[model samples]
Target: MKPHRYEEFRDLHRAGAPLLLPNAWDHASAAALATAGFRAVGTTSLGVAAAAGLPDGTGATRAETVRLARGLSRLDALVSVDIEGGFSECPEEVAALAAELADAGIVGVNIEDGRPDGTLRDLSHQCEILRAVRESVAGGLFVNARTDTYWLPGAGQAPETGERLDAYRRAGADGVFVPGLRDLRIISELTSGLTDTPLNTLHAPEGPSVPELAEAGVRRVSCGSLLFRAALGAAVAAARSLSVSADIPSYAETQALAGAFA
Candidate 1:
């Protein structure tokens, strides 16, 4: 059973046929997204933390994060929990958390090496965390190791990115994610460095299209926090529009929309 689900998640990352992951912040959003036809749903750390009025990527949302993952696991879509920095620096603790998530039926997890102070965790330490997680879950979880070199200031170029990803893949990461990296040249350079390890990139509206990324060798395109933000924007816009027009949505219309989740 574990292998079956794990393979299903892993197979979604195909070179030239990337998985377009839509991130959700809560059960309602995740359910709505699954109802909308997404096979998998990733939780955005930013969306989850912000919705709960906590700081994201700062080890403040551990309980909330776990609870959300547990809830989402029961949904129709495969759930991937974004555990910022594994919610601890200790590799053993991170592995324990991953074990719990695996027991909860989560198929994937996104663990990053970026510190809240805008620095990357040392390559060796991050690799240890990945290795421990890989050992703990025993191939049941799709560990998407994330490197934030491009997302941080004063970070080095492809040489450093490739070095870290190479170590991460060697450390047993099922896939590698580089958020904030949009350059086709850099992306191509980085992907070329990996040997069969799926390259995951954050989807950028102004960046390369899916086909372009496929050509560049990206196997997974994640919409991290974009959908959550868009939902917030739509809600605010709808309220403002109603105020400006002095109009209230009809009871029938409200019920119809609400019933989608029910």
Candidate 2:
């Protein structure tokens, strides 16, 4: 039986504590993390769509997203999907997608408020969708309301981030996510108005450490596509360096890697 992991994760957030959510691109990544002892795993939309050769947040990979979620459900961790903008502009449509995710054994979903079309979806519209989604899942899924205020190019992102989170909390979101905001001072400021709702931050390379983010009152930290991207970069760099240098990967190193595939 699939574990009712959502309730446990939800309760973790409710305790004014931190939950470090590692984003997995596919089954192997998720299963490895689960075996390594993660209680929960989040799917990075960037990692997901990029693997499928579709643009993230474009509604082009809905089928791929569902397939991946289905596969990850076999793991032991609570799975939370990043369903960018819920794949539709309509509230009912978003809610329907949430229902499908729930039926797939997804314990939670993260839906953003900004669209790829370069404008913020009206907070009211986002709230309507959130409410609809909350109502649809009778078993209570964790709805993480993500704000692209910082990720999107803009000068007014900070203020917009705070406003969006405030609205999301009032709309009954279990958590709020700001993907690109990493400063401790700014994070503290932004999370002040959101009472009871956990603040979720994306893990940045130059951002505050996990302990620091926890101290800053962030309840969740997600490594969104960083590991996958880093792996790709490392592979390409290894090939390039080996071509120019004598210190290439040894016979045993190459054999060990090849043996795994074999």
Candidate 3:
């Protein structure tokens, strides 16, 4: 990665407008996004796992995550990876994975506190993992600490959200991500409470727009699994459209898209 890429990615969060980050699954998706003028891209753990026929958010795709990171290093756009729960319960192991991703030219990573069994990880242990990852990357990687307070069923309330985020910030997280959080009022409160630490939230199609999110003080808006899921839907639609004919990219065009990175 370019020495300034990390700083460049960081600056996006501080810009006047909120950063609209799209997540990609593989080289073609990432390269296509970059070619279409997206400055930064992130990998969706669901996309990575599903593409490899594995389960997502269950520590089944660590090797696939790392391998995809290495391949994404070739893309022109800045890249961040979603490492679901860091694939381990050990802080040291999670830190080592972060380090390896940094070495692979990943500018950032999203390590969530959500676990495989539909529950959140212990706050103290999650903080330790964040601290270890932060120290491992030496500030070279943007560690976006993700909390599942809003994602997991009956996890906690709004007050707990602020508390967890506060602990993560103190643990050296560069940013805090809250997926499934859509209330503008609560989002504003969280951003206000966070102060300088960027607040990232997943974009919901039925929720707020980018401008609405920006106005609510969200520094980063992630597409999460939306794009991957949309792609799957599109593929099915295209197959069904065979009779009516669809305007899908030709084989050569698809090859050229992948070849851009090559």
TM-score of each: 0.92, 0.87, 0.96
The lowest-lDDT stretch of 10 consecutive residues in candidate 1 is 253-262
Tens digits of per-residue lDDT, candidate 1, 28-101, equal 78877787799888999999999999988899999999998988877867889999999999999999999999
Per residue, candidate 2 scores C-alpha lDDT tens digits across 71-179 of 8777767889988889898889889988888887789999998777777788898999999998888555889999888887772587777888988888878899998
Q: In model 3, which regions exceed 4 Å deviation? A: 243-247
Q: Identify the runs in model 2 with alpha carbons over 4 angstroms from their true place.
A: 1-3, 14-17, 241-262
| Tens-digit per-residue lDDT, 55-129, candidate 3 | 999999998989889998988889999999999999999999989888888999999998899988999999999
Model 3 residue 145 lDDT score: 95
Which ranking of candidates, highest TM-score first? 3, 1, 2
Model 1 lDDT, full chain set = 0.89
List per-prediction Cα lDDT, in the order shown. 0.89, 0.81, 0.91
Worst 10-residue lDDT window for candidate 3 reads 241-250
Clashes of 3: 0
Error of 3 at 67 (Å): 0.8
Instruction: Give the C-alpha lDDT of model 3.
Output: 0.91
